[model samples]
Target: MFPLSTSINLTLPIEDPILKFLLILVIILAAPLILNKLKIPYLLGLIIAGAVIGPHGLNLVLRDSSIILSGTAGLLYIMFLSGLDMDMSDFKHNSWRSLVFGLYTFCVPLGLGILAGHYLLGFPLYSSILLAGLFASQTLIAYPIVSKLGIARDKSVTISVGGTVITDTLALLLLTIIVGMATGNVDDHFWWRLTLSVVLCIVVIAVLFPLLAHWFFKHVSDNISQYIFVLALVFLGAYLAQLAGLEPIIGAFLSGLALNRLIPRTSPLMNRIEFVGHAIFIPFFLIGVGMLIDYRAFFRDWESIEVAAVMILLITAAKYIAAFLTQKTFRLSKDQRTVIFGLSSAHVAATLAAVMVGYNVILGYTPEGEPIRLLNESVLNGTILMILATCTISTFATQRGAHNIAMGNAQESDDDRSRRPEEHILIPVANERSAEELVAMSIMLKKPRDPNGLYALNAIDNRVEDPNVEKRARKILDAAASAAAGSDIYLQTLLRYDVNISNAIVSVARERNITDIVMGMHHMTPAVPGIAGIPVPAGPAIGRMAADVLGHSNITTFLYNAEQPLSTVKRHLIVVPEKAEKEAGFQMWMNRIHQLARNSGAKIIVFAPASTMPYLRTFGRRRPANIDFVVFEQWDDLPSLEHDLRQDDCLWFVMSRRERVSYHPAMSRIPLYLEQYFAGYSYVLLYPVQAGPGDSRYL
Candidate 1:
C-alpha cells in the first residue's frame, strides 16, 4: 500500500457538484431518444455510459455519494409502477391457466438453481437458496414490450401480465423468509414477527389505504398536490418497512397496490410517475448495473459459459412444465400454450437484484474484493446471456407456432398422425345480441391464423317438446353450415321440456366439450298481451339461471347483438376499471374482440388509465400507448383527465355501479346509452358484473 501523502495540498480545488450533476443530466437526456432510434433498449445505453464514467473507468467526476441511494430509488419506482399495473380482475376471472403457469415459474428454476448452486457450484445452503430465489423472480416487463410490439391488446398479453405478478410475488415472499434465515435474524420469535409483519401489511392495504386515499382524493382537488399525497404514502410505507427491518421495495409495492383499488386506472399521477422513473431513475439504475459488469471475469472462468447454457435450458424447461401442468382446463390452442411457455421463460433484472442482495448482504461477500463475488459477476453475465438467447428464441417460435396452431395448419407429427383423433370447432349460432357476441368471438379466433379443418354447430333450443325437434334443429344447423361454406358442419337441435335454459346449455357444453361458446345478449322483458300468451326472453341472454350454471367452468363466453347484421368487427376495445369486480367482464370482452380481430384481420386497441397524476412523483413515468382499450372508472369533462381521448370511432363500456351482475336493475338502462352510440357508428358496450360470488356485492 502507498504511504499517506506527507504534504497536504490544502489549496486543491473541489469539483463543482452542480456541474457534475448537469453532465449526467445532459448525457441521459440525449441517450434514450438517440439510442432508441437505433432500435436498442435505452437502458442498455445508460448502462454503458455509467460504466465508462464510473470509478473503474475514467473516474471523471469523483464524488463520495454511493450508487445505492440512486439504485434503490429507481428499484422502488419500478416496483411501484408495477403495482399500478396490478389489475388482476381479468386474471381472477380467467386465470386458471395463468395460475398454473405462475407456479411453474416459481418452482422449476428455483429447484434447478438450488441444485446448481449447492451440488455443482459448491455453494453453502443459504447461498444455494439465495440462488434459487434469484431464478424465481421474473420481471413483469412483457406488457410494455408486447405493447411496443403492437400486441398489447391480445389475450396472451393479459395472461402473461397476470401470471408474472402472481409468480413474482410468491417468489419475493419466499426470498424474504430465506433472507431472514440467512441473515441469522430468524430466532424463536421470528415466525411470529414475520407473521405479524405480513398481517399488518395486508391489513393496512385492505382496510386503511382505500379509506385514506378516498378521503384524500375527495378533499384535495389540486392536481399537483395529489401527487404529493401519493409520495407521502410511498415514503411513509417505505419508511415503515425500513423500521421493521424489511425491504422498502415491499412497502412501495404494497402502497402502489393499495392505491390500485382506490385510484382510477388512468390517473395522471401514475402516468407522471411512470415517466419520471422510466426517464431518469430506471436508466440510472441500469447504467449502475452495467458499471458493475466485469468483462474480464468471463475470460477467467470458461466453465461459467457452460453453466449458463445448462441453467438456461433447465430454468426454461422447469417454468414450461409447471405452467403446462396447471393449465389442464384452459383450452388453449397448442400455439397459445407454446407462447405462454416461451414468454414466461424470460427472467432478468429481478433475478440479478435478488442474488446481489443475497450474496452481498446475506453471504457477506463484496464484489470488488479478492475472491470476487461470483454470485454477482457470474449470475449477472449468466442471466443476461440467458435472457437474450431465450427471449429471442421464444419470441420467434411462439409467434410462428401460435399462428400455425390457430389456423389449424399444424398437423399431427408423423408419429402422432397415425393415432390422430378427428378435431372439430363448435360454433353456437345466435339470432340475438348475446348470441351474436358469442359467435363474434368464434370469428375473432378464426381471424388470427388457421382456417382449414374448422367446424360450426348450431344449437336450437325450443322449450316445448316436439316430435319433429330433430328436423327443425337440422334445418337451422343446415343454414349455419351453408353460411360456413359447408365445412364438415354438425348441428344439434334439442327439444326439451325444461324451461331452465342454463341446464340445457350446460348439458350440451359438458357432453360435447365444445371448444367455445358463442351467444347473444338482448333485453329480456315481458311483452304486451298481444295474440301470444307466452312471454319470451329478448336478446340472447340465457339469463342469470344459465350464466350461473356455466360460470364456474373454464369455457369462454362471447356475447353479441344478433339483431344487428352479422359483420366482421374491424376494431375492438377492452375497458378495464381500476376497482372492477373480481369477475369483471373484461376478459369475456377481450376474448370476443380477439376472436373478431383474428377473423377480420383488424387491429385491436387496449387502453388503461394511468393510476397516478401528472404533476406528482411516484413510480413509472411512461404510459402504455399500445393497448386499444382504456381502463377507467368514470368519465367526466375534466380536461386533464382522459381529455386527450376524445377521438371519434371510440367505444366505451360503462361498469354499472348499481347492479351486482349483468342481471341487476341498472343493466336494463344500458340499451339507452347503447342506442345513442349505435347510430354514430360507435358501439358502446355495457359489460355488467358477470354472474358470480365476487366483489360485485360491494359495487
Candidate 2:
C-alpha cells in the first residue's frame, strides 16, 4: 500500500524518491512524443521539459544524487555512442583534416574566450585561458541527427566527428593544467605524472581492452551477457581514464573505439547498445542538464545575463569562423559547412565538467577576507544559457543541413529521374545469421526520400508447419525489424508458410509491387543444370533458391555473400560487363553501388568495357564528392586482376538475367572463379531489372 500526497502544487517540490522517479519517467515518456507531434526535435523537447519540471520552474522535482549519477552516465553514453558510430576508415582518411579543424575550432574559441574574460569580465590571464578552453570544447549533440539522416559517412561529417575527439582531449588537458596551477601543483613533476598516466591509459585501452573483449565475445554465448559485458567494459574504460587523470567520458569513448571492429554496425549487439542509450541514458542526461538552470538567477543578476550573452556570441562566432575556413580549404558545399558548424557548436560534457572544476578553485581573497572562487555563479549560469542556445542551434542546423544534402544527392543523380520515386525492397530472410546484415545493406542502398521502406519476408516450408518453425521464422523477421529500427528505417514484417520458397517470395514481391529483392547467398550450390533451357555451368553454382528467384522474377535482385564484416571493407572492385550500360537496371545498380561505397567509406574502381566507360563515369559524377571513383577499361581481365585485390577489398559483380543484354557467358563462371580466387573477400552479385517485353536486346 502507498500513501497519497495531500496536495499537488505546481511549485511544491516532490522529495519522495518513488514519486520523483515516477514523475520523471512519465515526463520522459510523454514529452518527446508530444513534442514530436508538433514537429520538434525530441532532444530539445526533453531539455525544455526538464526546465519546466525542475526546482526553478514549477518545482515538481528537485535535483538529487540519482539525477547526478544518471546524468553522468548519460554524458558518457553520448560520447561512447559517438565513437562507436564513427566510421573508422573515414576517420583515418580524414585524420589530417580532423586535426586541422581541431586546431581551428580549439584555437579560435580559446582566443576569443581569453579576450572576453580579460577585458569584459576583468578576469586574470589564467582564469581567462581556462574560460577559453571551455569555449573550445564542444559536445556532438547534433551528430546523432546526421547519423539518423544516413549521411554520417560523408567526409565532412567524419572530419567533424574526428575533430570533436581532438578538441575535447586538448581542452581537458588545459583543464588539468589550470586545476594544477590553482592548487599549487603546477611543476615539472605534475607534468611528468600527467604524461605517464595518459600514456598508460591509452596503451591499456588501445591494446588490452580489445584483446579482452575479443576473448569474451568468443567464449560468452549469452546475448544478454554480451550486452552487459560491453556496458561493463565502457565503465571500466571510464574508471581507468579517471585513474589516469583524464575525463571518464574520454575513457568511454576510447572503449567504444577499442571495440568498434568487434561489433558490426548492423549486428543485434550494436542495435541493443544504441537502443539503451537513445531510449534511456541519453534522455536522462538531457533532462538533468535542464535541471541545472536556475531561471531566477538571470533576473536577479544582470551581470550573469550579460556574461551568458557574450559567451554565446563568442562561442557561436568562433565555431562558425572555424567551419567557414575549413569549408574554403576543403572546397566543401554550403550545406556541408553548416553540418560541420552544427556538429561542432554545442557546449556540453567537457564544457560543464571544466566549469564545475573551475567553480571549486580558489584564486584569491576578497576585501572581507572571504575566499574568492575562480568562477562565480554568474559565469556558471552564463555557461548553462550558452549550452541551451547552442543545443537549439545545433539541432535545427543539423536537421536542415542534412536534409539539404540528401535532397542535393537525389537531384544530382540522373539515374534517379528514370526510377520511381517510391522504392519497395523485399528482403528474404532465410538465415538468421545474415538477415540483419542483408536488411542493413538494403536500408543503406535505399534512397533517403523513398516513401516505401522495406519488406522483411520469411517464407517457411508449408508442409512442415511446426509451431516452432513458424516461431523461428517470426524471430528472424523480428531481428530484421530491430536492425531496421536502429537505422530509423521503416520495416514491414511478413511471414508466410509456403511449400515453395521461391514462389512465395515472387508472390509477395509482385503483390507488394516490390522493385528489388535482397537476400543472402545459400551455402549449398545447385547441381550443374540448364535454367529455362539455357546451359549453366555446374561448378559452385548459385543456390537453387536464388537461381529460381532470378529465373522467375524480372525484379532487380542483390545476392550478398559477406565474407568479412562490412566495417573492414576499404575498397569496392565492381566488374561491369560489356553492354551493361544498356541494361534497364544499370543506373539502379550504379546508385546502389555508390551508396554502398559511401556507407562503407570505401573507394570504388569500376572495371567496365571501353564502350561502357562514359556511362560509368556519369554514374560516378552522381556520388558524394568525397567518394573516390576510378574507371578502368578492362571488363575481360577479371581473372588476371585477382592478384591486385587486397584482403579488405570487396569484389562486386554486376550481373544480369539469362538472355538479357550484358549477360555474358563469363557471368556463368563467376561462382567458380569467386570460389577459387576470391574466397577470402567480401562480394555482392547484382541482377538488374529485366527490360520491358517490347525492348530490344543485342544478345
lDDT of 2 by residue, 1-699 (tens): 899879754436887777888888888899867987898887788888888888778888776788888888888887788778767766776889999999999999999999999999888788889899999999988766776676776778878888888899899999999878877889989989999999999999999987887667656646699899989989999999999988888899899888876675555577788888877888888888788767776787889899899999999999999999999989999999999999999888899989999988887888999878878777888888888898888888888898899777657555645654467899999767798778867876776434356999999877784769888988899988877876656799999877799889989988999888989876445565665522356668787777878877888798898775554455778787888888887777777776665444446777777788877777666554234445555545567768679867888888876677777777877888788888888888888876854587633
**Residue 637 lDDT in candidate 2:** 52
Query: On a 0 to 1 TM-score scale, where does candidate 1 land against the true structure?
Result: 0.49
TM-score winner: 2
- In order, the Cα lDDT scores of the candidates are 0.52, 0.80
Q: Which regions in candidate 1 have their CA more than 4 angstroms from the true location?
A: 1-16, 52-67, 86-88, 95-98, 141-143, 146-158, 179-188, 239-247, 302-313, 316-353, 360-699
TM-score of each: 0.49, 0.78
Q: How many residue pairs clash in each candidate?
A: 58, 1
lDDT of candidate model 1 versus the reference: 0.52
